[model samples]
Target: MAMSLWNPTKRNSVVLGLLSPRAMLTRWPSQWIGGALADSFEACVDVQRTALRDAGPAAFDVLIGSSWGGAVAAALIAEGAWTGPAVMLCPALSELRRHGAIEAIVDQIAALPAERKAQCLIVHGDADETIP
Candidate 1:
């Protein structure tokens, strides 16, 4: 969900910013299977690889993810779908339990392949009630 990599030129930045948020509506699936969220994380990475295969490799300066998006980004990187420096801010690993969802995202990430994980940047506000 943290896809700011469309185009960074001044001419295109505006359109890119606007399109990015709009794409969020299109990005997430309408319905995700409830119990299989964990198993599907890697599957998503596979899909990403397939989608990007024909597109060719592109420059990725860094990845910045917030809330649920951050968790997803971590999973994507851990599954080898993305290769770049990452920044996770106010990540929503607790949302799964908060909303009566499935297992915790943090736990899932802890189980990812060691090769896919790398040093990352995380920033969370202490006052934020999300992550205690």
Candidate 2:
């Protein structure tokens, strides 16, 4: 089972993931969250578009992220890119100036063809400084 941590196979069962910066670093969760949770799960660390495209067809049971990753997860879902349950921790939902235009999350969500926002639960702390 230990060898399966680095391997993405059917045997890994549910794929629980952490977002960028820590996405590719799977071992850290096992150490920090305790061994029990890591015992039977395959940690998918790479969630970037290029990586996802290169990986071919893959199914995710749920998407969980913090900070920038949280914002990414929300954007991906609102854009109808990823269809799955998600949990965003302190997601950055505001707009940013990119390429001389303001990119807002509200517009992204509104753009969904059939209102296909992925089922997501957001947990944000008022005192959080990373996204503030």
* TM-score (C-alpha, index-matched) for candidate 1: 0.48
State, as a TM-score between 0 and 1, how close model 2 is to the true structure.
0.48
Tell me the spans in candidate 2 whose CA falls farther than 4 Å from its real position: 1-47, 56-58, 95-102, 110-118
Q: Tell me how many clashing residue pairs each candidate has.
A: 0, 1
Off by over 4 Å in 1: 1-56, 97-108, 111-118
* Candidate 1 backbone collisions, by pair: none
Tens-place lDDT digits, model 2, residues 1-132: 222323345343223322223334654553433332222321222234445457544655777877556666665665555666779888655422221112555577667655354367789888876556
Per-residue CA lDDT of model 1 for 28-63, tens digit only, reads 433222212332333433455565455555745676
In angstroms, the error of model 1 at 37 is 9.2
